[model samples]
Target: MKKRIIAVLMSFVAVLTLSACTETVVELNTVSMFGGTDANRVVYESTIYAFENEHNIRVKDKSQSSDEEWKSTVISNFNTGNEPDVLQFFTGETAKPFVDAGLVMSIEDIRKEYPDYAKNIDDSVLGTHSVPTTGFVEGIFVNLDHFKSNEAKAYLDKDVWTWDEFKALCAKLVEDNADVEGYKPIAYGQNIPHYWIDHLVAAQLGPDYYNVIKGAEGEDKLTNALLKLSEIKDYLSYDETEEFSSQAFLDGKYTFQLDGSWFGGRIELENITVYPFPVVNEEYGSPLLSGFTSGFYITKKAWDNPKKRDLAVKFVEAMTSRETLTKFVTYGGGFAADSEAKPQNETKVQEALRLVSPRADFVVLPLGDASVAGTYAGLVEVQASFVNNQADTAKAAVKTYIEGQTD
Candidate 1:
């Protein structure tokens, strides 16, 4: 009778062990700029699937297109202590608040525990600023089909466009497409004018554009760039909220759009291609707006959770691995943060690299990312006294904003 009792107790213990093993799925929450129709999102999801299969962790992805509204929500979440476990955010002023609040984990801090935390990311590219950086580039996305239909096909044959040539093309596009229903020459809007500002300063300053953030000797160059914004005002369109809509471009109503390399993933059509924004400083040989600017950041919330801490680290490790960053570059996320990844096919991002690399005498980061907060604000503040007002007012407004910047 005692032997039978012992056997029954052993069986009960075995059942309890089985139930515990079955209940070991950890749900990790993450956020990023990978939602919408971005092709990179496919890779991101696939990685998450592989991670779940290899480990007992399930990722709760809450990603969306990164815009002003999305950024506001992220900041609000962190402020209220409802932030995600892992976050993919940018560097510069965008990251300053989070870093200052001690809400995110640094690669340095993580490495003390796991030496190879971000081994895939190089020391040179991991921005020592408040947050680390991956990389991104801005350029012009051209609808080749639209160009062909409008008889502007010949305009794209050149290696690099002179300022005169580029301006002429813009004028021609407006004239030819004015009567076409639902058609527009360019997809620029004052609501989002930084790319225009960025390329113009790059063209005006040549190699000196990078110093604008430092309050360097380029006030005249900046003024000239802002004046060009005035010159091109006729080509811009705004929605009800004075915001730029890339939807027009997506709807195939606009011929050209000044956008970033990351935007390439949104194109599913084969007729699209990319080029450097036109150059005014011919002596500078066509400057291209391209570089590393943002990256993945691990938050402190996950670090404090005993069960979530290691899982979050592993998730981040998989996300920032060399394999993933390479996929990011090849799939049109931007320039490779750690490797020279070329797409297997001729993606628009890869084509932009081919055309821009040899032709561009200089590569520059956007003023928003390159400059201090106040300087970038001065350059990009659309509500300021100068924007969309007049050529003289625009120039004066930008000059005041940039020149008046404090440390």
Candidate 2:
């Protein structure tokens, strides 16, 4: 009888152990995602927190110092087969290499599962960034309150203006507002190349940059664009002599500066407003525009790990969701790539959208070629040369730079 009791007690203990094992919480898988930028950090943090609360999973988010650092780290991890489950990568030829390298997994299946993809993201944006994969939208940020209707009408109405017209407008603003302390017409610093690569290229080329660069014999057109850009060298901003564009905008100095929409709220002053880039050559013909969009890519290894893959997709969906996207734009300031993510306050968001909206005659493409940084650097060189009356060498300096970029 005592032996029977002992056996029964042992069985009871085994049952309790099994029951405890069954109830043990299997932690939902954790995923590491890549993000960069202050605005991105804020939006991503909120999104991740929301996702974690909803799904009982922890996210390891790593924000890089810069876009380049993010790319390098992601690419290195991918090569080592230890890439983050999700990566925030820029769209275009820049991303093409990774996709071609078999590093990025195709999201064709994911897109199909989410039918709202097309409805939310515009077709043009899809063509540029995603159709083959996922696409992105590049948003140009403009300051509205600084220019106001009196000064902005000319640029916005025509949508596109010649290089001469652009310079004339800047000069006119400076001339009109000379009494205002440190009131420069516009500002961009030596740090970025867009003043030349994106904005000035369209005005300088007097045609679509894509048409020229993708042409069979595109050198002449490229050279022409280079020359035309050189012509308007004076109009470009000088951060040192003038106020930094962001500082100037904050100080109510310049009418405008070209930047990504993501920078809208942080850099925007209470009195200042935002808009898109204007048409480059409205009178003659619209010039091509350029933009850069940012998004996430998943790795094949991530796919193999079902939990990791699911987590990654969930993160992407969460981050790019209508709700999250709206919040992102509200704080971040770029055009909502998602259909459901339209601006909450039209007055604030719409103004920036209108500036970058597609026009019939105008075109938009990516900036940066082999000599990508040359245009801006060259512009500064020529501007200094001109200001100092070093005319003899300015033309030669410009020629050397334009030619140097191709080789």
Candidate 3:
């Protein structure tokens, strides 16, 4: 009888242990970072910390990977059901595949609960990516000290310049400083053509290029935009053998370069000024807005935990508030989502606002056909060939490459 009692007690203990194991709290993890490390990640951290404390939730913040590395890791974890609750992703057609595959969770419903999340944010800013995403603008950064007098302010103050006016100013600046020893006419990176393409498209076709083109040949505007891009080849630095455009610009080797506004903070330039990419078509009279999203995405692997998913939505909503969005964008060196928030860094912030505010019809969109992963890769290769005097096949090669990609 004692032995039977002992066995029964042991079985009861085993059952309790199993129940406890099943009930153990699972800590949810979220990874936040851009494709590369920078101030953006810092802002994300601050925002996440505040959110975690408020919600009594835990988030595992992981960041700092090359674009390729991030892509590979995100893809690997997703295929194996090991993805973090939230992962940083680029906004555009590129985000569609994962979203379509059911790898990303839609936060539209979440956005509704927190109206402030969507209120301050320009609905158009979300673009064609996910139903809800974050985006930053792309434009020229000016080193204000580079200019000697108020005359220098004229070009910057024009608010908007047609392509001709902008090119002429760039040429004038280069020509005026030509006699200065050790001056680079323009600091540019050849590894990517989207900056140049964005400028040209904005100039030639306005900002709608990102949303208008379903494919390469759907519209004649693609060809027209390509022609304008071909023209800018003369202005860009052929010697971008260096990987970083901001570094080259900071070193004072080049007068101007095309980069995201975040590059403004990468270096301390008290003399810096930011401007919109020049408008190419005077008739169209529209601002070409280069925008990118900085929103969080939920991977399918995290869907198993509905609580974690809800927490993720809450965190995103918290980060996107008008006050927080403005703070992040201001600190991160870009235009604020809320116009009234007023950036403390007035000069650069004002430049950004002026670039986007007027011309209500001005277009804002991402650079590539979101569906095509490597459309700009060929553009970069072609640019390199042009600089290498391998011009004979560069244009044809790019044209052929893009042509072949379509079918």
Candidate 4:
């Protein structure tokens, strides 16, 4: 009777062990900007799958297509105390609100724990994500094949071109391509006037000009930059829509278009080269308007739970690893935050890096973050008015807008 009782107890223990070994899956919630294009979707899904397989954690990805929409969703989720365990959001001013609200978890502990992983990422790039003041880099995409085929090649032979030379090249393209049905010298959209104004100002005034903007000299510089940008309106197509401008540039109807490196992934074209915006002042070299870091953050909710926190940190590390960042650059066409993962040669990203490397000091934070709050929006409005020829008194109109900012 004793032997039989012992045997029954052993059998029960074996069954319990088996049940524990085969327990249900652990699920983690994550949100990111990964659903926009097919390529981006593939890269993100594959990376997530790898993480899940390695970590034994299932991720419930709730990624959004549009950046604006993703930002709104994250803010709403945070307001309702439903923030995801891991969030992929923009860094800097865009992220300040969340950080101030105590929703974001500082990954300093995680970095200390995984020194090897942290070592690979550029401190400057990571600072942009963490410190809120260190800016991010943005590159311009150019259709190199179009330029090589056109007379504009001579002016673009060097990596850096003077503002006058760039304008002359545009004029030449417009004059030479006059008979080419839909050809335009350059791509322009009234919708993103802020981009035009920002690049022009950065090129003219250097990165530290934001401090100058608080006084008289900065105001003069801003006016000069705006006036320079206004001159390019003559070379742009009369169409006011971004869709029309982007399609025209992609279709090879325009010789040049100023945009972020992500533009490379969205368009299907070959021989597209990336370059810095032409500098108005040669002394400033070529300033790349970069000042927005978009990265992943772990939520406070996730950090409070040990199990969830481990998984979330692991996922963030994996997603930002050199291999994964390379994949991001491959599919997304932006500079990888991981400095060690060098971009492939003869690629658009490589060309951009080479062009911008000489004038690294010129990299500046976004106008909104560096200058007054809500300045970018107001500048955008001013740019549109100037481009539309509505600003009969350009300097006065811009000055009025600048003075109106409460910051």
Candidate No. with top TM-score: 4
lDDT of 4 by residue, 323-367 (tens): 877676667555665545555553654645534534343556556
- Alpha-carbon shift of residue 196 in model 4 (angstroms): 3.8
lDDT, candidate 3, 1-407, per-residue tens: 99999999999999999898756544567665542646566667787778767766666776765477776776676678777776666665456557767777565644555444445555435433232333456666666545544555577667666677766676666666666665554566666666665556556655555444445453455445655544555656655554665576787656676666556556555565566666666665645354545566655556556667666656656666666766665666556544455556566535554345333345456445432566666655665554444544555655554554453
Residue 133 error, candidate 1, Å: 11
**Residue range 78-152, candidate 2, lDDT tens digits:** 677666666666665566666778776665655655545434443334433232112223343444554534664
Range of the 10 consecutive residues with the lowest summed lDDT in candidate 1 = 124-133
Q: Count clashing residue pairs in model 4.
A: 0
- Residue-pair clashes per prediction, in order, are 2, 18, 14, 0
- TM-score list, all predictions: 0.54, 0.56, 0.56, 0.60
Give the clashing pairs for model 4: none
Question: Which stretches of model 2 miss by more than 4 angstroms?
Answer: 1-46, 52-73, 90-97, 106-113, 118-197, 202-217, 226-275, 280-293, 303-311, 329-376, 383-399
User: Which residue runs does candidate 3 get wrong by more than 4 Å?
Assistant: 1-117, 127-135, 149-152, 182-184, 191-194, 207-223, 229-235, 243-248, 282-319, 326-336, 339-371, 384-395, 404-407
| lDDT score for residue 384 of model 2 | 50
The residue-level lDDT of candidate 4 at 228 comes to 77
Worst 10 residues of 4 by lDDT: 127-136
Q: Sort all candidates by lDDT, best to worst.
A: 1, 4, 3, 2
**Higher-scoring candidate on lDDT, 1 or 2:** 1
